[model samples]
Target: MKRTVLAIDIGSTKICALIAEIDDDNNAQIIGAGIAKAQGLRKGSITNIELASKSIKSALNDAKRVAGTELRSAIVTISGAYTKSLNSSGIVNIPNKEITLNEIQRVMHTSLYNANIPNEFEVLHALPYNFKVDDQDFIEDPLGMNAARLEVETHIITTQKSNLNNLRKAVKAAGVEVESVVLSGYASAIAVLNADEKELGAAVVDMGGNTSNIVIHSGHAIRYNDFLGVGSNHITNDLSMALHTPLHTADNVKITYGSLYAPSNDLIELPVIGDETSSHEVSLEVVHNVIYARVEETLMIIAQSIEKSGLKEHMGAGVVLTGGFTKIEGLRELAVAILDNMPVRLAKPTDVGGLFDTLRDPSYSGAVGLIKYLADGYTAYEIDVNRRMRHAGEESATHTGSLPEEAPKFEPIAPASSTPTSAAPTPPVKDEKIAESATMVNIGSNKPVQDDQPNPISKFWNWATQLF
Candidate 1:
């Protein structure tokens, strides 16, 4: 069956909505998209629920109109400004002497429960970045393994409950339910980072209109996240103040003439503030100076954030820059210089089928990432508190001591290969005795494949590849 998914990204400058069709293979094909000028938001935080709701509604209406379908629920992006993160570890004994899904889930939950998150914050994502079984380290999937002890290290992301509540209220007022909330920085990282980058470690900076989101991805998950209240809009504001031009006119000038490198002596005409009939000429050098100052300061802070994360040494892949602010000319080169000579690359969402022309921009990375997150099942390892509560209720009613007959299967963390698979049927395991003694488990599959199963090693290898 085909599944329809909707993703919404609400930012300081704009609100975007995306609708896509997800295939059985978990590929997303964009069907429609909508963008509207953002209101009631400052520095990525909602200031007025009514105005924000209207903006969300406008974007949703446009997307629904283009797709010719009604969107009832959507995965939404939340700014990193309202989020915080930490790392935690949990260890448990395997009483059965064999690892299973239940043990994995329990270990993860233990880590979360031990975190002692503040009451004012709500957990958004709890990602397991490393696993250990007995004396073995870096065990990608411990399921079906003979182990007396299991350990897991996880990255926990939490958001301010007040801000989260306002975000949900805005979306609810827009007539759509929010299915999930993703950290804006993490979403951007998901949309752009590649397999190698994720494994080697990389920092992603999403420079939006009024805020910049910084996230560090290492060991297959986000290890740290930080936010800056300044962004591209600050440059525009500086131009308006320095040149005495209207805000809109200054923005136009910045887009047309802004650059950190190759500042020219040429002059450009600008409309004076509050005087439509009056115009003034400003030196291109002045415009460049204003933009340079803001960009420099922003990049400097981002560099400091990376250093502050204490994971800078692990960022072998360097920094990946995305978002609308990154579109400024010469930004990547400047980033390299400011980021301690680290490799810097500007990125956008990876290409997809259907109406994806407009969605290709860096500004849409968070929106596009929402669909990818949903299709990829990136939260397979996350502990669902509500589900656990329901299970507890059922257990109390039935007074049962046994585990559930069917456990939720783990999905692969890595992106799927583009190469097509052969039509030949997979051969069954040959050694029944050995298979029962030591079953080889692949995280991507619904069930554990025996050790003698075809390509068992390859399946495990693929599972080791983390999500980018």
Candidate 2:
């Protein structure tokens, strides 16, 4: 039976919900999606439980309606300016002479031992960036390797425990369960980034209402993360101040006339705030300048973050931009100007089943990516189970704990078929076991095949066509 997953992104300006299913081909197909204007959130931090609960409940209901099934649990997104990232090193002595999985796990655990978390913060994710055994380095997996010392460098991500608990309470009160919490920028990366980009190093920027979440990845590992306390809300405020217009009217005018590029005519007009909207015109040039200035500032902040990662020169995939604010006109061009000639592109989620036609916007990337990650994690577990079964049933199964021997060989648990035959077919045993003998030939080839992804092709297209 097909399995279903729910993904939610609790952003500064919106709460998005996505319901998806994994197909036999290992693709995430979206079955439903919901988006609600955010409330009780400031700078990516929950401020009011009542308002946040309402938003969560409304989005969950919308998703359930479209899914035709009730969802009890969901993966949610979290972002805040207070979140910090650091690279820590860990080492462990392998008493058994050989670096085993347990030894690696121990080294990883030791690397994250920090007594500085003020009792109000907890680690959200501990990502192992690289592993080393003895003197060898960059080992992705260290199992079965001959070494006396195992070492690992990990990226530790922590969030305020108080904030997490509040988010948990709000989600639970909305009649849903929180399966896991993922960083907003990381969630976007899971949905839009391909393996090569991840391997070559890229920065994912999630521009939201009041916060921009940044995550850095290189060699398929996250190296740094940071959040800047600025977003499209700054732009709106700038317009409100520059035009001397009310907040509502200023927002509308900015959306209608905002542009990152300067106009040759430099002519613009906006209604003056008076009785019945009296005839008053503001220069389009003024509106454009105000919006562009704030956007440039946001991009500059992101650029500085990239430089601080010490990976500005090694970024092979460049920058990927996603969020509701990215939908504004001329943002891509502005991004290109600020990103130092790197390849800049907007990413959107794809490969949904129901209501997919309406969920193609870049703003939904986080929720969609959460669904895809959940599906991939589930598929990996199923494959592992089948492998174990094959190993246990094989006649020549190796006793070594390094993976199952024969991918879980099967035995006949039932009597012969009802069809009568002149001669009874002998049940294969010992050396006659084809599955046992051929296990080594295809053991490592069981993973679902994924073809190459080209850089020029949009991420959405890559996601949509890869499933086939």
- 286-388 in candidate 1: lDDT tens per residue? 9888899899999999988888899999999999999989889999899898888999999998776684688889988888878887677353355431213
Per-residue C-alpha lDDT of model 2 across residues 55-166, encoded as one tens digit per residue:
9888888988988888888778887556766677767655446664334434555566532445666666667778888898888657678876677787777788878888
Model 2, CA-based lDDT:
0.68
What are the clashing pairs of model 1? none
Give the winner by lDDT: 1
TM-score of each: 0.82, 0.76
Off by over 4 Å in 2: 23-25, 93-101, 114-116, 143-146, 264-269, 274-276, 350-355, 377-468
- Write down the worst ten-residue block by lDDT for model 1: 423-432
Q: Count the backbone clashes (under 3 Å) in each candidate.
A: 0, 10
